[model samples]
Target: GRLVEWGGTRQIIKEPRQEYTNALVSVHEIEHQEQKPGTTPFLSVKNITAAYGRSHVKVLKNVSVDIYPGQTLAVVGESGSGKSTLARAITGLLPPEEGTVTFDGRPLANRLADRPKEDLRQLQMIYQMADVAMNPRQTVGTIIGRPLEFYFGLRGRQRDARVAELLDKIEMGKGFIDRYPAELSGGQKQRVCIARSLAAKPKLIICDEVTSALDPLVANGILKLLLELQKEENVAYLFITHDLATVKSIADSIAVMYRGEVVRYGAKSQVLAPPFDAYTDLLLSSVPEMEIGWLEKAIKGRRMASAGN
Candidate 1:
């Protein structure tokens, strides 16, 4: 067992109760267009209420949030909490029964076909399973190059050069362009997916649990790559996931979803800090730490709370 001492544990738990410190954390002014006095949101989902049916199954209930350019608004929740449904609704795969989604000051049609060609080209999605998203018959070149052809009409030498360039951006150089999905590693496949989305020169990308399937190291790489790409491209992301740790790692802002509602929404530092909502407190406590006696202490604390209740 590694005997590690958290020097601040006792101090933080004791929490000196200093009004000045509390006020400082509470009033930390986050800079953004949304925070600015008069600037409008880059992307706005206003009162989005979505349902699935033949039978009318309600998945999202009047959910709303704003996303800024070159930032991530991570939607985090447990399964069946309607995380994926939100993504589908935004992309117009599942039309919201009520409310509207606006991007760049213009309203988008809730159905894919009803939306303009520019809207389709500018909004992209990366699924959780990269293997399933990729076609086995198509080589990496075809998969990544096709989007460039469709969106920009680049062909032959131009297309191949662009494809190789994209491959390089994803950390897979020109040599790997000739390889098929089956020949690539899990991380490589995910990188190709990123390149494919980038090929569209998208304004926004709906990343639906893009890292959950990868190993910890691989996932970290993907997250780093995405952040680097975002800084270079100035693209926004509506990143969906269940992991709060993942949110803390990469999200600029966070929207915590519970039972089809956003219980908490704010900047990453503020949301992860103290004075969390009840469900949020529980959610935060659930994240495991690499330390001794954590589970036992948590169990005892929960037992005491339950007994008090």
Candidate 2:
């Protein structure tokens, strides 16, 4: 017979039957309470200027961003806009020439070898091409089990069970465990990659166009699965994609990049609203609208707008 205050309203705390629900609510509230003080960013890239060679043709130009806990920051840009470069920098594949990357308040090491394995485990990347990212010769079990074995030191039946658990988490059943990469379809292959990324139990996952290769329906299913995993795991995602439709569905915040610069960055609702940036307008207009002849209209409108400017 206890009264509980929830959202400014008082309700009677019911019997022990409702304990599970009450416990969940309490946990949710505790998370909010823990977040009330707000720690420093989980990952921070500060004014990073990177290049491929000594001539220093800058691929990323003073680029800065943040990845916080339990949120998806979708980075959108056309090809050659430095999106993948940014991801590589975050994962320690490339070193910045001008700035620093800090993970959980410590500066990221300049080389992958210099980074501690535990630090590497906190940040994981899911590549666009599943075929290239995964080992074609390896079975799904071996592919997914490698991370668990490497990071957690599990092997034999333990590793296999963990792989099976990861597969189930990604909506793939246990039957596919023994299958090879060539045996599965594109979507299933990507799901296997997802399982591998999840195997590390990473705090942050950089999904570099993870769903782009699949058909729309299959991609949607993958996105839904990602949302479910985020809910259960508290995983943060740096989702890099050119697909505005996907961004609208999954992004909490969006950063629109063009020619290695952030043209626009804000909450999804704010950035997608009217008074859009010229590039953002062009990007939004390019999405296949339900109305017929939308592409032509968008193109003509952009041309006219450009002429006026």
Candidate 3:
């Protein structure tokens, strides 16, 4: 593919001189009001350091972040930047070599199996691939109802009722109850995954690139649904993504990670405002704008900065 134009996303959309690029950037944008963070963070990951088993290499370097109740704290970075590793650490999939994860005023166990049943129930996770996350043999009802049954011991009609309610909550309605994963669209399957997480009535949901795999329109719908659910359920989110656009749409706070280190962290407005850290600036500048000579201009500016330095 030929590179035509590149700069910030808004610039790319509004000022594209290339017809090809203009056509590409034309899509609906999601508007979100930045929410204020509460005084107390319900989930605190303090100075976490982790590494793979049998390896001396540290993948996470003193990383830490606080997620307020009912808000979204997005951990953003490109691949191999420890975004997912941080998620793994918090979920106890990979226990940290150092530091602590505190939830709801109590310290959490370092490993998933060691955590109490209540801890597992209250801290839920939604992975990127909805298709693989659910079992193909299970009906949508069964997938969503399993959590309700597991967490609250709801069975039979009660579980089914709760499943239908959750389906409604995800805006999928109750019609999908009988469908299998293979029968559903990508977005629909993700919605079902979301409903399953909500079925547990979690206080915090770790959304690891939940919208990155879907079409833009479909992803926006999911983001809207998530925002709506957060409002209604008051469930906080640790939203992990590499997409800055997605971060702008949903994050109340942000933690910018690079090579296992948190380079920047704060409220959405502060973190995104001017005087950005080097990596954050690079990430923001790479958003691909629609200007006629935006790419050339950006390149020139970067070169000039490099020369001056």
Cα error of candidate 3 at position 307, Å:
3.1
Q: Mind giving the per-residue lDDT tens digits that candidate 2 earns over 136-203?
A: 99999999999999999999999988888888898888899999999999989988988888899999
lDDT of 3 by residue, 73-152 (tens): 99999899999999999999999999999999999999999998899999999999998899999999999998888889
Q: lDDT of each model, Cα atoms only?
A: 0.84, 0.82, 0.90
TM-score of each: 0.87, 0.85, 0.90
Runs in model 3 with CA error above 4 Å?
1-28, 290-293
Model 3 scores a C-alpha lDDT of 0.90
Q: What is the C-alpha RMSD of each candidate to the true structure, in Å?
A: 7.9, 11.6, 4.8
| Residues 57-122 of candidate 1: C-alpha lDDT, one tens digit per residue | 788999999988878889998898889999988889999999999999999999988998789889
- Give the number of the best model, judged by TM-score: 3
**Best prediction by lDDT:** 3
lDDT pick, better of 2 and 3: 3
lDDT of 2: 0.82
Quote the lDDT for 299 in model 1: 89
